[model samples]
Target: MYVPPAFKDDEVESIRATICSAGVANLVTATADGPIATPLPLFLDETEGEHGVLYGHLAKANPQWRSAPTGEALAIFMGPEAYVTPSWYATKQETGKVVPTWNYITVHAYGPVEFFQEPERLLEVVTRLTNIHEKSRAKPWAVSDAPAGFIASLLRGIIGVRIPVTRFEGKRKMSQNRPEADRIGVAAGLAACEKPQDREMASLIPIPA
Candidate 1:
């Protein structure tokens, strides 16, 4: 990612928060045949390694898991994002020099990938993942809700994945590079828009100290 100095996000805690909030990520791997990717919901085991470990599952029929990745795999997480029109900038009225831009947050995690088929590991991973997404619901479900034989059969159709994160690159582009007046205009414009993401981006616009 080409992040300018003004937009770089270096805080580890903030990065972790963004990843969790994203809920889904694009997992990419390069193989002898070509590059392939999958959109997956991953769980972060923050206690496992220096930067924490990522766990997920893929369909057994997905060839990406069976192919040997040539190098480190990448997981991309995206957060709130919205389009910024030139009309949102005060500079457009003052000097007519501003152009359209985008405001967003994202994180990239890279590490060696491991694929496993151990039933016990798969069961544990699926249980934890289910709990994470279901905890907020009024009637949360559990793996135990299914019959043991049925659950085992379901697990057999998927392969477990683990990636010990070796590094993370995070970026937050929220009009930090704009002048105070222009940024304020952007915030006000986004806040008044009907789109949920636009309103969310409005809250992230940086205020001058």
Candidate 2:
């Protein structure tokens, strides 16, 4: 991910938090034909492995899963991000050396990928994933809410994916390389932005404890 030392975020909990907040991830695989990617919602089981295990599903007709991956798979999780303009840097006024950059959080997880379509396992995966995303709703839904026959028929149209994470590399480039004054300016500028995502990034900027 080309993370500089100043921008590296190695905290395990922090990385997990980012992954969960992402809700969906980009799953990439290298195949004999070429690289293929799928964007889908995934849930992490932190207790399953030394690192953790990721679970998700894709349409059964998606060719990306039909072909065997030739190498390790990568799941990319992205968090809040915002554009940082030179105008937000105090250094711009002092030395006119600052340039535009992106401030964001990302986590890359690598592991062997496995694709399966067993109906029982597929049902379990679907139920758990639904719970994770629906738990916060005022009127939460459940896999059992649908007729069993209907749900079974629907499961046949998708395939489940599992990845036992081997390692994780996370980066949080939140204006950490800038001076304290410059960082404060960036935070203030982001907080005042019209985009809600910019305000979310503002809350992540490190302020003096």
Candidate 3:
């Protein structure tokens, strides 16, 4: 993705945090037929490689997985985002030259892809993924929550994915290009928004009022 220096996010820890917080992402692959993408919930093993490895699953019937990817696959993780109106800029009052923009955080990871059907590994992946999302629930579900036969049958209908992220790019465009006064105005406007995501993005702006 094209990113200006002012908006570039090069901090490895911060980038990893953004990916983790995103929870779900779009995994894209190019095939002889065309490009295919699937939205997936993934787990990252940061210790695995330079940028770390991503693990997830897709439906066994999803044709996207059957087609061999010609090149590296891409995973996009998007975080908090908020709208910035011209009115939310000091320049709009001073010179009326400000334009509307958006403040958001995102990460793009690219790597070679591998798909597997190992039942034991699939079982482990499913269990950890389930625990990650269900830990917050009062009554969390588990892979063993179902009958042995039923769980085994269900696992047969899915495939596991492992991609070692060779490249990681992160972008955090939170009004860093704006003047201090404009940044403050935008943050305040977003904080006042009724949307929880907008409010969350407002809090992420590094430039404080």
User: Per-residue error at 107 for model 3, in Å?
Assistant: 0.4
Cα shift from native, residue 2, model 3 (Å): 0.4
The candidate that achieves the highest TM-score relative to the unseen native structure: 2
- 110-164: candidate 1 lDDT, tens digit per residue: 9999999999999999999999999999999999999999999999999999999
Model 3: per-residue Cα lDDT at residue 92: 93
After best superposition, candidate 3 residue 60: deviation in angstroms?
A: 0.9
> Candidate 2 lDDT, tens digit per residue, 81-199?
89999898889899998789999999999999999999999999999999999999999999999999999999999999999999999999998889999989999999999999999
| TM-score of decoy 1 | 0.97
**Clash tally, candidates in order:** 0, 0, 0
Alpha-carbon local distance difference test for all models: 0.94, 0.94, 0.90
For model 3, the stretches where C-alpha displacement exceeds 4 angstroms are none
lDDT of 3: 0.90
Residue 78's lDDT in candidate 3: 94
In model 2, which range of ten residues has the least summed lDDT? 200-209
Runs of candidate 1 exceeding 4 Å displacement: none
Query: What TM-score does candidate 3 reach?
Result: 0.96
Candidate 2 clashing pairs, residues 3+ apart or interchain: none
